[model samples]
Each structure stands twice: as structure tokens, then as C-alpha cells.
Target: RVMYTITKWIEHKLGLKVNATKTHITRPNKLKYLGFGFYYDTKDKKYCARPHASSIQRFKRKLKQLTIRKNTMALNERIRQLNQVIRGWINYYSICNMKTHMMNIDKHLRTRLRVIIWKQWKVPSKR
Candidate 1:
């Protein structure tokens, strides 16, 4: 069978002698999943007898980097929420101080008005 011959060829190229106990003949999950001899070329659209091991390693490394990036993004979002709460508290304190100062001025103005009216009408000061 062509498949058997190809498998034998692959084992020979890899310097791995075929052992019946170790080898298992299985159907391809998909045409691409079959690990046979194949060479791929990006420039000329060619697929030859040998495949590149570098492609497999590169894919694994890229997946690792993506997982790290996702964790960092989640941490940054949590820090952003904490900073927003701190800023809200700061703004609330500033407004409260301003309101207290305004109330003190309002009380002083009312006391001065009462004093002036009492002097004009010859009425005794209440306090």
C-alpha cells in the first residue's frame, strides 16, 4: 500500500527503525493532520517531501505569549477600577470643604445685618 511505503520511508529518514509494537497505523483525522513527508514554500506555493519543524515550535511559542498578554490585561483593568474610586473620594472631600466655608460666610453676613437694623431702630441687641 502507498501509505505503508510512505510511513516506512518516514521512519527510515528519521533514523527510527519500525517496531511493530511501537507503531500503530491510524486513519488521518484530516488530510492536513497526516504527518507525512511534505515541504511548504510561501514564495512559489510549493509543497515538497519534507515539512519544517520550526513551524510547530513557533506556533507553540505564540500561544504562550497570548496567554501572558491576556492575564496582564485583566490585572490592568482591576488597577483602573481602584484608581477611579480613589479619585471619587478626593473630589467629594474638596466639595465638602467648599460648602463649609460658604456656610460660615452666610452666618457672619446675617449677624451684621441684625446689628445694623437694631441700631437704626433703637432696639436692644438680642445677644
Candidate 2:
């Protein structure tokens, strides 16, 4: 088809190679690019974008590393560090309308922070 011809032209004429393993010839809704997933919104009858599940998982992994209790950092210092990272991540993905997903992430982050604080307190009486 046209795509095959274009790939051949690029390879032969331009001396560029295409990685077939990463290529997708499907609808935009089925393709993921730059940590974002595209999907067609039935209600709006338009295309929409959201962070892919893998991207969210990666973010959570980083957050978990930052929140680990063994770091021994002061509570204020830990919050400051987490704030910087979360701010940058939010800014980068702000274009995607993922309010619900963000809410869930925020809730999970709060839970992690609470657990870290409890561990720092070391006792129910202190907590």
C-alpha cells in the first residue's frame, strides 16, 4: 500500500531504515506515542489523549522510590523533594485531560506520604 511504498522510498532513496517492530498501521485510537495513549471518545465523537498505563506505572515506581522510609530524610525535606518531582510531572502531562486518573494518583500519593509519616513517628501514641 501507500505506507509500504513510502517506507521503501525512505529506505532505498533516503538511506534511512524503519524499525518494523515499533511501527503501527492501525487507527490513532490504538496507537500510543510519547507516553500518551489516543482513543476515540464516543460521547464527544472525537479523539482524546491520556497517559498510557505503562507511563503511569513508571511514575508510580519513581514516586515509591522517593517515598521509601529508609531514606531517613526530614519530613519537610521529603515533602519538598516530592513536590518538586510531582510538579514537573504534572506540568509535562498537563495537556492530557486525565483528571480522574490524576485524582487517583494524588490519593495514592497521600496514602504513601501518610505511611512514611507513621513510620517516622514509630508509635500509635505519637501518631
Candidate 3:
């Protein structure tokens, strides 16, 4: 003898197409027409206003924080590389420039080198 069992099957599906460029949600009060002025009113009835949703406000706040974090990380990495280059230059000067220091070597060269290095590192000020 054999025992039989029955089972039910279910299927579900959903589709989403995200267009980032058109995602902005505009509010009614912001709309304006030149000849019509802000809006039209019939008796006490009028094209009225509605405030932005709380979710949009929170999303903007979080987006700003993320942007700041990304910029800080990029700047920190550039500073780290600049420090390494400066250390190499100091070693070169100690081994070579000092041994070959000559009056004929232009003082302007040192100033130029300093400026170039500062610019490359994106430093704020020369002094």
C-alpha cells in the first residue's frame, strides 16, 4: 500500500525600472505661471499647497553626509602620498645637494621646487 499527499504551488513576480534623472519630487506650491500669477482661486476654493515628504528630507540629509565622507577620504589619500614624496626629497638633498652645494646653483630653484611641491600636494598656503 502507498500513501498520497497533495501540495499547492504559488508564483509571484514584480518589475521595477529606475530612472535616476527624473526621480526628483516637485511640490505644488513651487509651480507658477506668469499671467496666472501663483495660482487661481474659485470662491474659497484654490489650487493649494502641500509640503515635501519627511522621507525626501531625510534622504537629502544622508546624501550630503555621504558626499562629505567621500571627499575627505580622497583628500586624505593625496596627503599621504605627498608626505612620502617630501621624505624622499629630503634624503636626496642630504646625500647629493649638500655635497654639491655651489654658489652658482640658483636660489630661485629652491623656491620653485617648494611651490611645485605645494601645488602638487594641494596644500593651502606656501608659508
The local lDDT score (0 to 100) that residue 70 gets in candidate 3 is 28
lDDT of 2 by residue, 9-123 (tens): 8899999988877764778777779998887889999999888888889988988999997888999998998899889888888888789888998999899899998888887
Which candidate's lDDT is highest? 2
Whole-model Cα lDDT per candidate?
Answer: 0.44, 0.86, 0.37
Model 1, position 12: C-alpha lDDT score = 83
Clashing pairs in 3: none
In candidate 2, what residue range of length 10 has the lowest lDDT sum? 23-32
TM-score of each: 0.21, 0.81, 0.19
Query: What would the TM-score be for candidate 3 when compared with the true structure?
Result: 0.19
Ranking by lDDT: 2, 1, 3
Stretches off by above 4 angstroms in model 3 are: 1-73, 95-127
At residue 29, candidate 1 shows an lDDT of 24
Which 10-residue window of candidate 1 scores lowest in summed lDDT? 28-37
Q: How many backbone clashes does candidate 3 have?
A: 0
